[model samples]
Target: MQTIVYQIKDAVYANLTNRCPCACTFCLRAKGPGVYGSPPLWLEREPAQAEIDAALDAQDWTRYRELVFCGYGEPTERLDALLAAAARRKALDPALRVRVNTNGLSDLVNGRPTAALFVGKVDCISISLNTDDPDEYLALCRPKFGPAAFPALLRFAREAAQAVPEVVLTVVGEPVTDLAKQTRCRALAESLGATLRVRPFENGTRRFPVP
Candidate 1:
């Protein structure tokens, strides 16, 4: 069976699609079928809007503080479905916060400036900054967009800050991203009106903290 929605800590996660433009070297999907011992996230097929809504409806709203659009792939790969789910969640319970964990390539993926679409649909958006160097990002992430990806990602973050309530850019801690690099990333995030979060890297997987 496909796992559409699952819980991690106080958040309920929505698994939308397995499509992503970049293939990062430290991607968790390469290490295992799941993250933090959840069910296999590789969807047999992308869930439709109805299926996604049904999954959301089934969840006990009182238990989860946030709804996150994140799974084995980039959430923006299915931008429409993601936004629809977030909108529905907000309509059902306005207090329940909604977030999207993304690679910041939505514009390239959808062929337009997509950050403005978030507006009031999502409460927060966490983007992976990875590194401060463009060459390093190209090497580490291996995005299909080649040299254009990094610039687009930065632009997206800048736009997202204006659209979303909380915009965060994250980098892995220690070995993956050193202290000096993390500091630069923090500065970069702040320049774009976003905060930086240094996620802990453990057992080859980035541990995402609950929002």
Candidate 2:
């Protein structure tokens, strides 16, 4: 069976979908069956709320410090399901920190202000800011929304910063590490009231032991 919930380090991750609007060149899906030590994430169909609740309920919640909505595809692509599952998790333990790792194209995908949906349910929102330049972002992410995706992403990040407790914009270490570019990314993130995180490129070829 495909993995619905899996461990990565100390956090538990939920795989909600394989439907994504962007075709990122560095997407982990292209690297292997799953990231770290999880099983293949390609689901036969996106899990409904009941299945997600069961998968999460099966786990010893206290064993993980955080629960993240992330997998082979964009979690917000399954917005209703994501919200339902997150609400269930938060209801179980109000103190549990819940997060979503996304491409930040959710509003564009939904054609609405999706950040508002996360307000009280999520603790953190991590957005992929692949590059500071719009053109570079388009080239790297190749979003189906086209050039408009860049601006929409920025708007989403700004809005998310207000709706969620913590908002972070991230750049992959390998492709966007020039001193000037990093500086620009940090400044832009700061302008949006968000922090910039430089994520190291993990070798997705093997199943890493969970800590």
Per-residue lDDT over 1-211 for candidate 2, one digit per residue giving the tens place of the 0 to 100 score = 7689988778899998999999876676776777666788889888888999899999887788899999889989999999998998899899999999998999988889898899889999999887899998888879999999999999999999999999999876654366688899999999999999877654544212111
Position 128, candidate 2: lDDT: 88
Error of 1 at 128 (Å): 0.5
Model 2 gets an lDDT of 0.86
How many clashing pairs does model 1 include? Answer: 0
Q: In candidate 2, which residue pairs clash? A: none
Best by TM-score: 1
Query: CA shift at 146, candidate 2, in angstroms?
Result: 0.1
lDDT against the true structure, per candidate, is: 0.90, 0.86
The TM-score of predicted model 2 comes to 0.93
Q: What is the lDDT of residue 84 in candidate 2?
A: 90
